[model samples]
Target chain A: MNPLPRIPSPRNPAPLTIADLGEQGLLQRLQPFCAPGVVGDDGAVLQPSPGQALVVTTDTLVEGVHFSATTTPPEAVGWRSAAANLSDLAAMGALPLGLTVALALPSTCSVAWLEGLYQGLAQCVGDYGTAIVGGDLCRAPHLVVSITALGEVPPPLVLKRNAAQVGDAIVVTGYHGASRAGLELLLDPDRALTGLCPPSPQQRDQWIRAHQYPRPRLDWVPWLRSALAQGQSASASRSFAAMDSSDGLADAVLQLCRASGVGAHLVQADLPLPPGLASWQGLATALDWTLYGGEDFELVLCLPETVLAGLEAASGAGVPAFGLRRVGTIVAGSQVTLHGSDPQEPGRVLSLDRGFQHFSELF
Target chain B: MNPLPRIPSPRNPAPLTIADLGEQGLLQRLQPFCAPGVVGDDGAVLQPSPGQALVVTTDTLVEGVHFSATTTPPEAVGWRSAAANLSDLAAMGALPLGLTVALALPSTCSVAWLEGLYQGLAQCVGDYGTAIVGGDLCRAPHLVVSITALGEVPPPLVLKRNAAQVGDAIVVTGYHGASRAGLELLLDPDRALTGLCPPSPQQRDQWIRAHQYPRPRLDWVPWLRSALAQGQSASASRSFAAMDSSDGLADAVLQLCRASGVGAHLVQADLPLPPGLASWQGLATALDWTLYGGEDFELVLCLPETVLAGLEAASGAGVPAFGLRRVGTIVAGSQVTLHGSDPQEPGRVLSLDRGFQHFSELF
Candidate 1:
């Protein structure tokens, strides 16, 4: 074997290696950003901040599972992960602060792809005035992005799940079912439709944009907080009791009711489906989609009857102009019912109750 | 023709689906232990403290990249992820406080597996007296665990990378090269050793245990702090100028010298290799292995020569005696060298000129 090629070694008398360089290099880079009570002798040090409640939420996006490697852009993937976590913060009426991201990718993944992902994340953090304090990266079989958002809520303004009461008027933000419709079109590209057989470029753009880059409504928190502060009436203040609705309308309403130990009767006719999707059969399908589709990231507010005027005023001032429709009324009992145009025709009301389950095919 | 299974008409109202549960379930489950400023809103809220500094470190573990699916248990995988992050904290001489874990698993993964992983994580967190306050979970092609550890250090005691000066003696906690040797046995079980091979099952257990569960010397922090506190001399006051030797000795020394803007020379004869691993050829073959091995989560300290006596006094008092050895002395230049037994063997005096490069084939 030719004497094993006589491997050459270092001639100097000191000991150093590449591994040390990387570790020390990282320490040098992070030293300036170190803050007290954040880094601990054993791990991360957390000092208690009494009186201020913490709102924590985490979201994960995976290649192939949540996004396709072939279709979804990496930038969009990064944006959506942040948006998903931020939306949870908004639902709690909490102010966004900082985030920790964990990313895993195959060794073969390009550096450009990683950079693009960070660029998108940086943009989102900048838009929301948050800092990317820390994160983890590792080589893996596929791409995965996971983020945990931390927010603060002054005691008086914190929103929660267990506060929705009976007679609360349910309100949803923005039109629904568009995302589900967009997904259908993307998944079945060759399918033909009777009314809008194929969307114009602009229409496709609108749907695709909505599907890919849903913005979290951080601006809504202050409005909700201000409305609650007025103390106008129990009915009015109660309306802002709950604020999350990402899964779907039916499921969200059910959650609110369960939390408040109540039930609800929803008006199926009131849901705002896309205008072009309102044919007789299409309307029914659109309603079903609205009731069970995922990734809408919309807010479902459980407010009292008196807050309707405030909501209408806010809508007029152009707060993203959510549909603000009254889809349901909280009631005593533990079940949900759907009401059609004909009050007497209870049988005509269709209930789409299936919601998104993370690991289940129902999603 | 078999009646095409009546695809549920899109117009029909379906019962509340599981997908509709949304994030509410997760939020409810996590609400109790989640800390404020660590969760919710736009980003996490951090309250900085005076006279203290934060230390943050992140680590990621992938299913196939870091551990084989067949050999590594899920619980062990979780434990290892936390251990790696905690190890970084120990290297900084910072106190461990809290951690955030992000997990990505395939949709088909069993719930029991997830619970087991969490149980392992919970056990580790409990051992460290830290909380798993927040994290994210999502579906992916393979399991990925990313952890971020946050630590804090009092201003007076905060150890740094650039504090070593000329003549500072090098000291290391615990033994070296054993992890690399254990890994060798693991990778090539049939590789027979001529001598130093453990003859009993108990001895074998002791050898492999060091590799699988290398404990972070958290309990030693207070002792180290006290020892360094009575700094009447230059060496005594600056007991630990730098830390973290996971990437191995040669790599670690290079980092210390580079950061301190100095040079160091270690005596090959002073290296503390394990009992069974000490032949001239074995030393030669394993010298590189010990010098370049990563995952040896040991702390390396640069102290003044005056404190050496104090350290010995403390070590003799049953304080988990670190295998303290005078490996080298800091010099005024930026070069690392190794002195051999013979002065004329030019290349025998090695210099660890580079830090360990991660993801390299040698790993």
Candidate 2:
């Protein structure tokens, strides 16, 4: 293992653990990331835009369970945690506002690790024009970073999982399967890049980066808002539904269907596999990665016929459309079915229990 | 140890671990505690009251560090976590709206543990009319609960630590030493109730409860709002400063003074000791506990003479005044001094390093 790279702190004379930077010192160092007049008070104050309803979500990442200390850097851990929460806000089609972090670290954890973690957090928030606000720091036996992100949306524009209806087009933004593949690359002992698996170094790096820094689909929020507004006219996707693929596409689709009491038939061929997967030696492994790989942080929206047509027409226009794919359609049932070659043939009906169960997966 | 107590869940038919409930099932079980229409969506949506400024605070409690599974019940663990964050809101005189909890528990942890924790959380929020808006649940090696509580306050009525003024009266609501004494009873291996120390069973229980469920002073928010409003007038206590005594009265006083760029002179004789402490054996021990005990969840306010006059006159009429003692005064210098007997003699000046150093205390 490599010795930790030294990250200099302009305030401290090369301190070791966070203990070297006392509570006040730590707060002072992290204050720059906070919104103005928000870091020192008992609680930070925020004023939402007029007629806006605030959207909030929290996600917790623990060492060893969520990420490996050996494989993933502290900064990436922080970035991913923030990204997970931001993705939830994006799923709601809300504009990112601010976030508060509750971080607990072991006494042996280095000050450099803390700095790197905050730097990553700062970078993510900086990109979205969001402030860190104030947060709590404490001691724990291991590392735990919990982030709560707050955003705002016009009340009528809020997207929900229970809004999906029959005949709605199921569309997903961005490519899928990369994050899970990345995890496999990092964890698989027999992988070529680690002198055991077949993948090249560049492929491994791309996959790993996908897992570490999954982009929260904030960029697609404007498009979603525009679609939602037009759909409210009773001629678009007025019964629209959307959710982020954090628990893998299959599981997330099932969740949305179950919530809305509808079924979905997703086409396997239409599923966007991670680039270069065609050269992979195993078909089953790649399929599994595409179908059930969690942490993609991509949006899956159910659009009515009118909105679907509009989106399809606007796809090649000024909109930032990359991996947007029309994968399937909502149906009148409770099962999620997947079709391979032909839609007329029998499809593979998937169960809710097939995907990532956070508790079961941890063990 | 006694076998785990049976806490029946009418919702689940004898579930064992979280996996049995599954993610959706678990969310459904906990949905009753959340605000209406807020739990099922990707993110909870909240509409803050018109003209209100939202206050947000997050606090995390870790197993082995914040509590012992052997000594503290899961309900108390949840209760304390909620209380800690709520206390921060009380310090700001904000009316709590809702809270989102991010819980990471071990896979082997019982379903009953999760139920008990939420039950306690529900009770706290119920008492204040605050809702459990939503939360995240996941797996960890140990229990870690992070809560982000949201509240609202009129901007003009916001309480701040940096608002303290020179010659202002330093007053505290409720006693402080009891919490530290409780912690000592819980942590000291040679304590009487544990068959080694001199304290009785009743005394031990009192301390344990104090440590486990420190009440947030939501009941006092109205009085604070009224005080802050009246103080806004030219003749009232315009230089008001306030914060919670989470890190002992001395430490909290020092923090308020430091933030305000002022000093404080506290009289030891005026410090309110917990009731029945006269029977205790040691004066210095009791004094140390009173001066440096953290987690008391009491409010310490620096009030001007005019505001103090109005508060004193209105105390018993409508306010729930308990242990409201004038312990000291804000001074001109940057030191916190305590006079044991006479002010003419040299006093004890407290340092910022005295209490609740999260990292240093852990080691």
Specify the highest-lDDT model's number.
2
State the lDDT at B293 in candidate 2: 75
Task: Show pairs that collide, candidate 2.
Answer: A191-A196, A191-A197, A192-A196, A192-A197, B191-B197, B192-B197
Q: Given the true complex, what DockQ would model 2 score?
A: 0.64
lDDT of 2 by residue, A60-95 (tens): 888888887767776787778888889999998898
- Chain A TM value for model 1: 0.80
> Please, what is the TM-score per model?
0.75, 0.91
Give the per-residue lDDT digits (tens) of candidate 1, residues B114-219: 5446555665666787767667655566878777776666656666666788888888776777666666666755553434543244434444555655666665
For model 2, what is the C-alpha lDDT against the true structure? 0.80
- The RMSD of every model to the true structure, in order and in angstroms, is 11.8, 4.2
Q: What are the candidates' individual DockQ scores?
A: 0.19, 0.64
CAPRI level of candidate 2 = medium
For candidate 1, what is the DockQ-based docking class? incorrect
Q: Tell how far residue A238 is off in model 1, in angstroms.
A: 10
